[model samples]
Target: MSATDWIHSFDRFDGRKGIKPGLERMEAMLLLLGQPHRDLRFVHVAGTNGKGSTCAFLASVLEQAGYRVGLYTSPYLSAFGDRMRIGGCNITDDALDALVDRVKPVVEEVAATVHGRPTEFEVITLLSILFYAQERVDFVVWETGLGGRLDATNVVTPLLSLITNVGRDHEAILGQGIERIAVEKAGIIKPGVPVLTTAKGVALDVIERTAREQGAPCYAADRDFSAKRTAYGLDGQSFDWRGIGDHHVALRIRLLGPHQIDNAALALAACVQLRRMGVAITGEAMQAGLKSAAWPGRLEIVSQSPLTLLDGAHNPEGAAALAAALKELLPNRRLIFVIGILADKAIPDVLAPLTELAAHVIVTRPDMDRAAQTSDVADAVRTLAPTTPVETMDRVSSALYRATVLAMEQRGAVICTGSLYMISEARAVLVP
Candidate 1:
């Protein structure tokens, strides 16, 4: 099939399935595909936040260490091909079409069987495993689509498992409270595998208990290894990571946000674990990868003059991190915000942090069926930041236009955040 045809077919398949969170269908599909996931080695990562950044850092470091690395992340910012990459380069359109073509027959056969049909995430995940195996990749850095235990990507028994941190996300599916959420996230822990996490408090206790039960050696971020920020700015941040058997001072990373230092530490700790598991990772490669790591749509600066930035702060924890970054980086400066979020997220919690930083707020809806209504978000803003000037724009482009004008007039920075969907559209508009 042509790439266009494949895209259309895949889009149709994608529309058919919604959030089927379990391993039965996935296991059946992978079994039919010769259990390719078992043959491949992976560095599996799961968490509410920082999974993408942590995966990016790990992949870059593995590639720098002269290994053929396969990196798989979800919810692509711009292109579907961005989900599957090797050595920092995206999978080609031709390759994607071919992969879909190869997997369609198996998918159809499974759909007709008692096991039932697999979801889009499951198909994409199986395809990634097949591609990584066919390409003879040395290691695959895999990011879970949702909560770990039941996520399609959890099929692999990874060499090292890294949970960046646990937070209240997908509450409906994963359950309420940090402990319940931590159990789901800790589901990725494999027996006898060394799991590294930056999670603290009740979440940490849950993970530790789960790891102990599974006979997995768990490395807590602050207890086992940690990163201390030495310098930070809008440009970049430098930190000291005290990792297992290695102490790297002044490790520089291009990604912005204070939370990223913890992410870098998790990545470093994962690398250290990978080394213990007989993977060749040098000190030089670790530093080089830290220097080159970057993930888009998370505190990303797209425009300079008006100082427009995009962040995917879809939840309370993420909002707090974004707010902290703004306070540290742009303290006492005028800040304007263009926000759009999904209907399912906590609106008040997401708005509270942005409202504190925003002199004026423009509420809008992203081009997604699940996006929260503009009026709903506006109401939340009024309740959270009563005195803050608010405007409602139905369209993202119009919201950006209004925010840009307000930022220019106030000599302030324009922040577009609340959801990854909005950030994706904003990046396509502003960066393009």
Candidate 2:
């Protein structure tokens, strides 16, 4: 099958089977596929935010250590093929086409079962696992799509589990409160598989309890390891990571934000566990990997002169981090935003921090059906920052171009952000 044909068929299989979360369908599908994920070693990562960035660090560091690492992530910022990759390169189109064709029959077989048809995420999960197994990559840096417990990607038992942190993002799917959300995220913990996290307070308590219940030794940030930012700018961020058995004084990361430092610290801690598990991760490779790891569409500067940037800050916590990073990096500089947010997200909470820094906000809808109405977002912008100008645009490219022109006119920076869907469109328009 061609890429377009395969993608169309995959989308048809993506509908929700039932509201109640269970892994019956996923288990049935995998069993039909001959359980390909069993022979592979993975570092499963789950969290409310920072999962992609954390996965990037792990993949880069492992690759720097001369390992053929497969990295699997979700909600691709630029391309669908980006969901699965070994090191920085995506799987070839022909390979993906063939894999989809091969898996279609098995997916059909599962669709006929009592478990019913799997979602698009489930199909992608199966495809990625099969691809990794076929390639025989040394390790796979796996990220959960949503809450971990019933997520399609959670089917694999991993070598090390890393939860970046927990927050109240997916209230409808996961639960209402942070503690409940933490429990769902902590479901990635496996028996005797050492776990690491940057979570704190109630979230930390939940994860600790889960780890204890599973007999997985739990290591945490600020307790077992931590990152202290010494200096930061758009160029990159430099921090001091208190890693296991070593005091790494200066660790540099290309990814921006203080939150990124936390992610790097968590990944660094995971590296320590991998070493204990007999993976050869040298100090030199750790430093190199930490320095080289980059996650595009997250504070990625596509244009330097006009200072146009893109970030996937779809949730409140992520928005807060983006706001803080902007204040610290470009202090007092004017910011014009080209933003599109999903309808399911907390629009007010996502806008609150952003509107404070917005010299102007051009609201637009993303490519997804769940995207919030542009007018609704503009109303929220007015409520938050009444003085800030708001303009509604239907297309991400047009909104981004308009914002860029406005930013240049006002001598300000353009930040194109909100959902990954919007960022992906903006990236393809601007960078592609």
Candidate 3:
């Protein structure tokens, strides 16, 4: 089948319509596909916020260290190809088509036999593992799609389990509180494997206990690995690692915000652990990889004429971090914001932090079924920032244009955030 045809076939497997627990189906499918996940070593990353960034950094560092790396991340910004990368390049269309075709019959059989209709994420993840194995990847960095325990990617027993940070996301599936979420994410920790985590607060306690209970060595952030910021600029932020040794190196990461510094440090710490496990990574390679790592839609600046910043700050914590970064970068200038969000998120919580930094806000919806209404988002912003002007637009492109015009007229900055889906849509329109 053609690539577009294969994608269209899987698109029908949406709406959380068919999801099952246990790895039996995945295991059977992999076995039929020659068990590709077993051909390479893995570093599985699971968390709410920083999993994509952390996976990108780790894979880049490994590649710099002279290993062929495969990186699998989720919720692609553009094409489905963005979800799978081999040696820093997306999988070729030919490879994708072959893998999808090979797995189609097996997926259909599983769906028929066990009443398991695999979701789009499940199908794509299985394809990634199979393709990575076929290519003989030296190392694979896998990010969990949702909660770690029943996540499709959890079938692999990774060399190291890394949890970047835990927050209240996907509450209906992962659980409501921070501790519960931590437990779900900690499910990736395999027995005798070292689990590295940057979680703090009650979540930290939960993760520590889970690691200990599972007989996994726990490397908690601040206790086993830590980072302290030394400097920050538009160029990037510089930080020193304490537990990993006196590696006084600077990074020129394209991703903005102080949170990225922490994310980079977490990836560095994971590298140190991998080296201790005999991965052969060097200090020079680590420096280069950290500086070169780029995860788009996380405070990505697309334009300089009116200074447009695109960030995927979908939740409250992320939104707060984005606001702080904008304030730090443009202390004297006001901001015009074009924002959109998913219907499931708490609109007030997501908009409150961003509204504090906005001179005016334009609300819009992403081209997704789950997107929140633009009018509702506008009303919420008005409730928070009564004096700030608010406008509602039907599409992200229109909202982005209006915000840019306003920013140019006022000599201010335009910030696009709220949902990754929205950021992806806006990026395609504005950047092009």
| Global lDDT scores for all candidate models | 0.88, 0.89, 0.84
What ranking of all candidate models by TM-score puts the best one first? 2, 1, 3
Off by over 4 Å in 1: 1-18, 245-248
lDDT of 2 by residue, 99-177 (tens): 8888888888877878776777787888899999999999999999889998888899999999987888979788899
Superposed Cα deviation of residue 148, candidate 2 (Å): 0.3
Top candidate by lDDT: 2
Q: How many angstroms is residue 315 displaced in model 1 relative to the true structure, after the best TM-score fit? A: 0.6
Encode model 3's per-residue lDDT on 1-432: one tens digit a residue: 586576557653246733455667787777777777776799999987888988888888998999999999978887778889988788889888888778889888887876466666778888888888888889999999888988889999999999987888778767788988888898898998998888888888888888889899888778777777777777677777766554455555656788887788889888988888888999889988988888889888789989988899998888888988988888888799999999989789989989998998999999888899888888899899999999999888888889989999999999999889898898789866
Q: Give the TM-score of candidate 1.
A: 0.96
Clashes of each: 0, 1, 0
Where does model 3 exceed 4 Å of error? 11-22, 244-252
Model 1, range 196-279, lDDT digits (tens) per residue? Answer: 999999999999999999999999987889888899998999998886665655699999999999998899888887888788
Best by TM-score: 2
**RMSD each, Å:** 2.0, 1.6, 1.8
> For model 3, where is the 10-residue window of minimal lDDT?
11-20
